[model samples]
Target: MAYTAPLLNKPAEGWKHDLPGPNQPPTRTPNTRLLPNPPNYVDDIYLELPRSTLAIRSVGIWAAVIFFLTSTVAPVLLIDFTVTEGHLPPFVLNFFGLVLLSTFLWIGVYLWRMDTEAPRDEPIRFNRLRRKVYVYRFFHDGAKPFSRTAWGVRPVAYDWDDLHAEACSLYGPMGTGGFIETVTLAVLKPGTHEVIDRFLFTHEIHRGEMYWAMAQLFMQQGPHALPTFPYVPRDWNNEDVSFNLARRLAPKVVWPAEMDLESRTAP
Candidate 1:
């Protein structure tokens, strides 16, 4: 099933001030008063870490089997019994070296598999002031073997001005028991952060048509030169039907010019 759009109840705030066009007048609106008994805000959608114990065990078993076979069989087949004086056979030496290399390869594969299975915690918090979302699961807290393993973690932030859209396909099977295909215009924005403490700018692409609609401000008035990411749709017609219908029925979201500017300039 396609994802549902979230209702934004917060009052629109001033987002941008300096209009790009001279004739365009500044748009302003009254801020929505806070609810007397507002419900607590919580983030429920997030990428989940794979947690398959069977997968982990399977990898472990494979690694052990490979190590045992190589250690026992390679030595027996490669070692020469009747050595001339004290010299070892060249073929035997090469065979042992190959076995050692195979062992190292198996070990590397085991490590990689473990890393891929690392746990991911959910409901990551987003800080508007810092313009970044905090990822809680990618870091370890202790010095143990598993704790020493590092997972890839990065902040999610975007530049409102550098956003754009382009058509692409989304790969996956639809709910109707058929392959889905689509030509959606992905919404993208530029992001900045430190990878290993080095400054870098990366393009952040928002998948699904709903995100594009939610971020309409950028789609309508932001930068026009951004690129779209490729996708493969599972069900093109269904996606289009759902997305377009939602867009038509969704409530209009308005933002104040100054607040728009702040969101655009947020780091």
Candidate 2:
């Protein structure tokens, strides 16, 4: 399916909010939902989550199952014919065996299939000390990737300020229905705003929290910080009610309407 990038407007021209009360001490610290020391590594994590794999893939899992099961029909028919006919030749039986072997082998190929969901130690590591992002892969669960010859993906270290973090939706095949949202953290060339490398990529539902956490990281530690959440807003953003604790947990940082505070500003 076709999709355009979520338009990110840098602090809109002539738009601003009343500076958050300094005495108010931010109401509360920004809570970034992160998986603490998942399985193996110990670094300040920016974002981490399970992505769909062959075993867990909604499409691939079904596809492999469907393809593998369909192959069984041919062998089953051949076996039935040989048993029922009684006078079947030896070559016919051999061919049946071959078909059965091939079917079993095909299914075996996907048995170990899994997505990039690695353990805590072999996870996507973002070191605050080194200013780098490292994606570690492993064949064995408990081993550290430093000495072992494990698969490490292209993880770029950025200056942080140049990293553009956003929550964007990826449209599938257009005909397949809705979009899948992802947490995209990439480095952009200054001025022209060309994307360098999408250093961090996570496809999941909690993209807002990830995006906010990432933004908070860069803003406070990397280059700048903004007290806002990335968009488009979720199911929680529509409510205008004043009573619910869920809504009141955090101040509305996603006000597309309130951002334009020109009229509300002191004239």
Candidate 3:
């Protein structure tokens, strides 16, 4: 299916149309025979997985662009402007220069905050025993990502039944000719189809089923329902040097005390 925009606020649909076989558990979301996205941490009670793949190189690229614009481009523009319009008031020229420099700086900072300032890995936790899902999210206004308001680690708990998964895809920016895909779990507003909230299940389109099935199997049938071999437990703390460094630089995953208790504990 060809999609031009990010899919949102619709009923979860478009999984493989086949019926489940004998081994698969009865689930609202589709199941896959293939292995699920492995958890960063798992136990009898809960399963935890990372939000997205981190690209450290992207950070460096942005940093370089910011440096070049502020140091080189700003000076060149200011010098040219002053020479060309010598009759203009010094303060007016200075103001223009400041605004131009500030715009570039803000763009750099905004991108940095949007990506790097977040927790090293915003993981989603499936508490099977509690029949609830805990999302460690960095909430910001959908329309205003650059705004300071409506932002932070506002983690939430949702009943397993209220959640639905959908596979969404969109074309990348014009020059890039790239494609972007994500499996998203949208939280419904009780009896209505209206979407209350949503988050990414996995960024990979091909493996979206596995990720969805992983959560579905765990929630519907418990930890025993999942595979044991390639889906072995992993320690997020003991990851590679790059991960360790990023973890150190990023904010710690600190859930609110009341929510922490409620999410992990059974009713």
**What TM-scores do the predictions have?**
0.29, 0.40, 0.72
TM match of model 2 to true structure = 0.40
List ranges where model 2 is wrong by over 4 Å. 1-29, 32-70, 79-111, 115-122, 128-130, 137-159, 171-179, 187-192, 205-215, 218-267
Between the candidate structures 2 and 3, which one is better when assessed by lDDT? 3
Q: Any residue pairs clashing in model 3, and if so which?
A: none
| Highest TM-score against the true fold, candidate | 3
Query: Residue 159 in model 2: shift from native, Å?
Result: 4.2
Per-prediction tally of clashes = 26, 10, 0
Error of 2 at 176 (Å): 11
TM-score of structure candidate 1: 0.29
Would you list the C-alpha lDDT of every candidate in the order shown? 0.29, 0.38, 0.62
Candidate 2 lDDT tens digits, 151-196? 3222223554455445445565545687755554545575545665
lDDT of 1 by residue, 1-267 (tens): 121321112211211111111112212211113111111121122111111112122344355456656556555545544244355557757766677866655554454444333322111222233333222223322223233345333323333332222222234344565322221211122342111121111111122222333223223333221123233212211233342332233222222454333333434
lDDT of 1 at 259: 38
Model with the higher TM-score, candidate 1 or 2: 2
Cα-based lDDT at residue 197, candidate 3 = 76
